[model samples]
Target: MQSALLVNGTLISDESVRQEDILIRNNRIISTGNNLSGQPGETNIIDAGRKYIIPGGIDPHVHFALPTPEGCSCDDFHSGSLAAMAGGTTFIMDFVTPAPGQNLIEALSLRRQEAESCLLPYRLHVGLTWYDHTITSQMQQCVNEEGITSFKVYLAYKGSIGIEYHELEKVMHAAASLNAIVLVHCEEGDLILKKQREFVAAGKTSPLYHALSRPPETEASAVKKVIDLCRKTGCRTYIVHTSAAKSLQYIRAAKAEGLPLYCETCPQYLLLDESVYRKPLPASLKYVISPPIRGREDREALWVALRDGTVDVVATDHCPFNTFGQKDKGADNFTLIPNGAGGVEHRLALLYTYGVLTKKISLQQFVALTSVNAARIFGLFPDKGSLRPGSTADVVLLDPDYTSVISADNGLQQCDSDIYEGMPISGKFSVVTAESV
Candidate 1:
C-alpha cells in the first residue's frame, strides 16, 4: 500500500491531542508528528484543513439486519455501516442471532460472510445475540473462536426476547463461566406488557401510554433483578440503553460494591425527552424506544451520571427503525411499534454538540464514551478504535466550527426518517478513513 501523510489537524487519540501529521503505511498508523519531523520520508501529504482528527468511534451496540417486534431492522450490514462511517464511526459490534440448534461459530461465520460482501466499507465486529438455550453453547463458541467477546440478554422483555427468571440466571451463570460480558435490555417485559394491556383495554391507546407502560420502575426493578442474579452468578454485566436516573443510581451503588457491572446511555435520553413521543405523526414514533425516555428529572440525572463518571460509555445503540410504517405500525398498539431510532449518522455529533458544548461532559470524557471505553469493553482496542502507533489508521476529521442542519436526506442510515431531523449541529465529520481505506 502507498504511504500517505494526514497533515494539519488536531490529532485526538484515546489520550491527548496534538497538531500532527499522521503517517499511514498500508492500513497501520506508522507515525504521527509535524512534518514527520526527524522521521522517515517518502509520503504523499493529505491536508486536513486543521480539523480535529480523532480516533474512529467504536459503537458497541448496534443491531443491523436485526429482527424486532415490528420487523427486521431497516438497516442491514451495507446501509448500517454506511451510516456508521458517515457519522465518524469506523467500527461497530453488531449482534449475530444464533439460530436455534445451530453452532455459535457457524452463526458468526454466516454473519462474517454477510459483512464481507456488504456494500459498506467499514470494520464490523460480531457479538452473540441470545434468547434461549442458545446462550450457553453459543457463548462457548464466542469464547473459543474469539469471534465474539460479548453477549446480550434481555432482562425486561419477558414476552418475546425476554428471558424468564431461571433462564436469566442460567444465562448469567453461563456468561460468568465463559468470561463473556452479558449486556441486558433492562425493562421488565411482564410489567410493561401488563400495563400495555390495561392501558389499551381502557381505551387509552395514545403514544403517551408507551412510556406509561414501561415506567422507570419497570427498568429499575429489572436492573436490580438482573444485578442480583449477576452477583449470585458472579458474571460481568452491562446495562444497555440505560434511561432512568434511578436505574443509574443502582448501578452506581453496585459499582461502589465492586460489582462487575457497567452501563451505557444514548443521545435520545440526553438530548430529547418523553415529550418526543407526544409529537405528531413520525416525530412521536421516532423516540419510541424501550425503557422509554423519562422526564426532565431523569434526563438531568443521566447528565450527572455522565459527568461524575457513573456511566461508562455513551453509545447510540444505533439501531435504526422507520418513522413511517415501521414505527407507526404500533401507533395503534405501541407494542407493535419497533422500539428504536436511527442515530448511527448522528451519535458522535449529537454527543459532541450536546455533551461538550452544553458542559454536561468533558471533551476527554466524550472521547472515552465515544471511543476508548467502547474499544476497551468490546475487545477491539488498539486495532480498531485507537490512534496508537501500532493501531490502524482509522480516523475521523471533525471541523468543530463547521455547522450543518441534520435532515433525513443527508443521513446515511438506510431508514426512511430521522428522529433528529432539522436539528442544527455545530460539529460535523468532514472526513473519515477506515482500516481498509
Candidate 2:
C-alpha cells in the first residue's frame, strides 16, 4: 500500500480531538501531530481543511446479506459497508448463521468468502454461534486465524439461535477458555411464542401487538438467566441491542456483583418507540427489532443509563430488512417481520446529531460509544479505533457545521428503505481514508 499523510484535521480518537497531521505507512498510522506538513516524496498527501476527525466507527453488531426466511434486509456487505464508510464507520462485526446441517466453521468460511467477493473497504468481524459443542474449536478459528474474536448466542427464537440456559452455560465456559466475547440477544423465546399465540387468538394482530407479545418481563427474565450463567462461567458477556430498561437492572446488578458483564443499546431504542406503530393500520412494523424498540419512558431510561456508567457501549444492531421484500413480509402480522433496521449509514450521524449536539452526551462520550470503548471490548483496540501509531489509516473527516435533510435519496445502502428517514443531521462525512475510500 502507498503511504499517506492525513494532515491538519481535528483528530478525535478516544476523548481527545487534536488538530493534527496523521501519517500512514502501509496500512498503519505511523505518526500524528498538529499542522503536520507532509514530505512530498512518496507520501500521498490529504488535506482536511481543519474538519473534525474521528476514529472511523466500529459497529460490533450488524447482520449483512443475511437472508431471513421472511424477507431480505436492505444492505449487503458492499452496500452496507459503503454506507458504513459514507457514514464514517471503518469496521463492522457481522453475524454468520450456520447453514442447515452445516457447522459453525463451514458457515464462517462461506460468509468470509462472500465478504471477500465484494472487495469491501471496512474490516469485517466474523460472528460465530455456540449452537453445537462440536464446533466450539471451529468458532475459535475465527479468532485464531480470521481475526473474528466475538460470538453471539440468542436467548430468544426457540430451537433456532436460542440456546437453553444450560447451553448458555456451555457457551460461557467455552468462550471464557477461548478468551472471546459472548454477545446475547436476551428475550424469552417461549414467552414470545406463547404471547404471540395469545395475541393472535385474542385478535391483537396489529403491529403494536408485536411489542406487547414480547413484553419487558420476557427480556428481564431471560437476561437474568444469561447474566447468571456468565457469572458462573466467569465469562465476559455483552447484552446486545438491549431495548428494555428493566433489563439494564439485571446487567447493573451483575456489574455491581463484580461480574464482567456489559450492555449495548441502539439508536432506535433511544429515539423511537412502540407508539410510532400505533397507527390505525400499524406503520409500527417498521421498527420491529427482536427486543423491540420501546416506549418514550424506556427511551429516557436508556439515555439515562448511557449518561450514567451502567451502559458499556452503543451499537446499531444494523439488521436492515427492506420495506418491500423484508418488512412487508409482516404486513399480515407484526411477528413475521424480519428483526433488523438499516442504520449503519445513520448511527454516527444520529449520535452526533442527537447525542452530542443536543447535549445528551459529551462529544467525548460520543467518541467512546461509537469507537473507543467498542474497540477495547472487542479486542480491536488501538489497531482499529484510534489515530495512534500502528492503527489503520481508516479515518472519518466530519463537517460538524454542515447540515443535511436526511432522506433515502442520498442513501448508499442497497436496501430500498430506512427507518430514520426524514431526520436532519448536523454533520456529514466529507472524506474517508483506507486502502481505498
lDDT of 2 by residue, 1-437 (tens): 37777766777765675677887776777788765554567667776775787787888888778877874466777787778878888788777777544666677778877777442444444344335656567767766777766778777888565667877787678889888778888889888999998988887777788888888889889888888788689898888888787888777778889988888998888878787667554356667777877878778888888888677788888877766766777777777778777788888889999998889988778888988888888877878778788887667788888888767777887766667878888888754643333
- Residue 214, model 2: lDDT of 84
Candidate 1 regions with alpha-carbon error over 4 angstroms: 37-42, 99-106, 119-135, 430-437
For model 2, give the 10-residue run with minimal summed lDDT: 119-128
lDDT (Cα, tens digit) per residue for candidate 1, span 1-437: 25766778787764676778887777778878777732345455667885788888877778788776467888888888777887888777777666544566777778777677454334333343345555577578677866456777666655445567677788778888877788888887777878988999998776788888988888889888888987899898888999997898899999899988888998888888787767776567777777687899999999999877778888877776877768877777776777777788788999999888888777778888888887787677777667778887777788888778888886677777777888888787744432223
lDDT of each: 0.76, 0.76
Extract clashing residue pairs from model 1. Answer: 156-187, 156-189, 157-162
